[model samples]
Target: MEMCNEDKSNDDTQELSLRDKFSKLFNELEHCEKEEQKQKIEETNRLMEEMDKEEFKSFIGYWKEMKCVWSLHFGETSLSKSLKKTIIDEEKRREGKNEKLLVELCECYLFLINTISAELMPICIPCLIKVALKKEESEEAQNEVETALMVMSSAGYWEFMEQELYLNEIKEIIQYHQEYHNLKRLAYQSAWQFLINRLFNDNNLEGMIVNELCFVREAARELDELLCCVDWKREIEREEVIALMRWFQTLALYFEFCHLWNEGYAELISIIVKAFRASRDDHREISKQCIHLLRKAAEIEVIKINDLLKGGAVDLIFEEILQSTSNGEILCDCLNFYLMISRKLKRMEDFKTYEPKRKLIKKEIFEKMEKEGYEDIIISLHETFNYLSKEYFIHLPINISDYFVNV
Candidate 1:
């Protein structure tokens, strides 16, 4: 037994600890021992053959059992020491042995088995997510979450439809993960990535995925879930864990806008914008999280148009722009979210629907611009109006100085 987990408290997790487990599993693989190694290799070959069988039935049960054992036996520090001793024993038995080659042989066998059979996945993925999240939890949770989320988003449904078997296994992993909130979220993300991988292979599925909006809804919902994890009231540093989760959330932001166009989903997106906004006051780093998500939303055309609208819950955008302007340097963020909003407001109405709303919007935008002392914005708005329509924007800017001059 190798010491895998330093934190004994997480022992209840089925994959126990990860540290010394894989190396030990590799070292102890009888396949490497001259006499026993032959038998184990033969057995592995038989298993591999069976994996390609007309009735590849035993694999599911074997992998399930493997998951059970690995989860329970992994990652205990004490276990790590035991495994280290095993390594020493194995090394001593072959005094003139090449450690690197032995390690490589073990890894190759494990890797081959892991890839050909889905068995290792049930053992590995959840634990992989766990360690990744646990390690990046602090100062970086958001980024970790985003990375995970992006993977899932890219996975989508069509990918799973093709790789149905792997997808099914992933579902099992998801079930195991659901019991733990962190894993549940990650599994959701992973499911999406699995689909994304498939989408690349098939254009029909890709087109269909694009036509439907599952990616959009799931991405926003996931971001909300990840962002909700930040409870600033009780401060603590689990940088490893937080970093992991943050990374996951960052991925979610990418998938939402880059793939699904979350900016089109006004209600949920506003919440994302606002939620990130509330955190800006706590720490500057958190404020960056706010900016990341907002930039994601800003990337879409629909959001850009909607940002200036007063109704359909568009007031939130205005409030966000104003609140952000007051929050601090975040206003100067790379996305220039505030600048986007201001530019939209300053532009004269382009479409018919926009025409009706332009009058009141012009007044409100002018008010905010002057309040912010953004004179360049006035010139830009005037230019925008000229490009769109001489008539639509002609009246709005003439009164810009008057609006500022009077106040």
Candidate 2:
């Protein structure tokens, strides 16, 4: 009987020890959760610092192993899933209570992915995009899209571009939405990054970029809509105008290298001419961008002189020079564009195989220039040349008298 009593006592002791161990573990986990929830930045820093320790294999592995703990804390297993749940819950919360919790949660996720490892971005990005694409168009939805775009903009990983669904969804947002300028701006920036990556970083995607999907065409179409709808006169539209111009400039700058300039040439030249003609003191920055784009296109020979003249670009250029002769930058760009056109004309005239059309083309260019008041261009060029020559005599030793003999 004593032996039986001793056995029962031992069993009771073991069961009590097990209960204490569980209680200690539970408390430790709770403390960790509170610490992480309250001090995400600190916790993230701690995790990153400890990443090279012997215990943690890698940042990604450690985060994956913490899935269960995260599930217990946030009621979702994966960070992506947790983010989606938080967005939904925040939307359901009372208007007053919907504070910045969603933004905080999203920012935390963005920070983690941006700082630690973007290996998980493929999973996280899609979820964020879905939230962004919700048709509700509520304040919550717009916030979600904005946050998602912010996160996407931070990720430099190129694999995200490989996902057609992801790219298509972003393209849709940029194409259709005119209200969310911030979201649209970010989307355009992100798409530009993706294109840069594909063109410069990933060599394997060249064939796909050329044949499978032409982003240039899509970007051009969206730019057309922005130009058509935006009221450039409004102060509120300034940022949007700048964003659109930057996007158009990027396309004009790089599309030639991609051999996709033909896809966007006509539309781009038309828009650039319109922008240049619309230039005023208030819109000087956009005018500069338009001129910069024109210079890029002209330098690359993306559009012929005849094509530019036919598109009314010559008149616009001369007009810009006539209006802004005192503006050194405008004068320089206009002169450079004219010089490029003259060079192209000379090249055509010298082509032995195309000699038959050279005289006709030359006559056409001269008549167009004369019709658009070429005398103004010559006067502007002469004044600019003389002014610059005198101002920078040390750098410019040419004889202005001899240089203007032809004019």
Candidate 3:
């Protein structure tokens, strides 16, 4: 029988010092045959996990000196190992051996990140960023990008990434990859999910978030093109629609908070209107975001009401309300869309100077609602809204019927 390198101490820590134990494990791991190295590494990880913080830090020092972990995979020091070499090397390309090993390296890297201190993450980020943005073609390349994104998504490293100027890498990755590529699209979409979630949760990162709003607009435009397509049902999946909805929600919140919709406001409003009309009843989440955006536009009155009418905003809301009567969330959103505009026009002192535009907007909206035969539906919607408000304790300063009545 071939005996493994089992410790003879039999669980007796007094027999060997922690340093001696780590040394023994690392030495055995280093000398073990390739087939046995994985088992030895697992044992080492378990031992390291049992160590206290100080002991783990000391082990890091010894492991760095030995270069045991990365050396086994890449035969290069951790400091010098470039993920790109594992990705695009011509020799490795021919042998096909580097691919699996590259995957193992990624797994190992993640494990270390999970088990180690945040102080150690910075050293791994440069290589991660390189492969994340590398536009290579292969499963191995995809694995590299995915793993890099996984590391980037780790909250432990966000501060390091922010300090190191790697914060924009996710945006760059989103811009660099084509949305039509199924596999790569999933990776970047996931990265976007992580990024957007982080941005939404962190209140102190407002300044950093402002710079990303432009990129958000760009992403919204891409989504608009897809959603407006005739074959969008085939091209866009539910997951992609969910991502689009969240992005729109984020953009709408930004507009409401900052009133930064001056740049390309008309075009964006048009896109929002079109997306609402296109998605209709099939994607209520997306429709809810569209209504939210339109309400923000109404609250700010950044674009003239005539421009919104021309963009088909009034008709879009009516159609959405007609189709979404069963979906109370969408119905409430549509009602709020109109009430928001009414509230702004009725309450704002500044609108006194712009009464003609507000009156014209209100007149045109009523005309459209009457001509389209949606007045009764609007009345029914108001009744339902009142019922819901009482049942759910939903309170608004202004009532839906009072929207069209004189202040």
Best by lDDT: 3
Cα deviation at 374, candidate 1, in Å, is 5.0
Using Cα atoms with residue i matched to residue i, what is each candidate's TM-score against the true structure? 0.42, 0.55, 0.54
Find the 10 residues in a row with the least total lDDT in model 2.
1-10
The TM-score of candidate 1 is 0.42
Every candidate's lDDT: 0.42, 0.52, 0.55
For 246-318, candidate 3 gives per-residue lDDT tens digits of 4575455455444233445556677878787666656666666777677666666555555566666767776
lDDT of 1 at 148: 36
* Candidate 1 per-residue lDDT over residues 254-355, each given as its tens digit: 444344333336655555555555565665565565555555555445454454242223344334444524433343332144444545544544566776
Residue pairs with colliding backbones in model 3 are none
* Candidate 1 deviant stretches above 4 angstroms: 1-183, 193-213, 225-230, 236-264, 307-329, 342-354, 357-364, 370-407
- Model 1 alpha-carbon miss at residue 387, Å: 29
* Runs with alpha carbons beyond 4 Å of true place in candidate 3: 1-130, 137-139, 150-165, 168-213, 228-258, 281-310, 322-325, 351-356, 370-379, 390-401
- Cα deviation of 359, candidate 1, in Å: 5.1
Per-model tally of clashing residue pairs? 75, 0, 0
Query: lDDT ranking from best to worst?
Result: 3, 2, 1
Every candidate's CA RMSD: 15.9, 18.8, 14.9
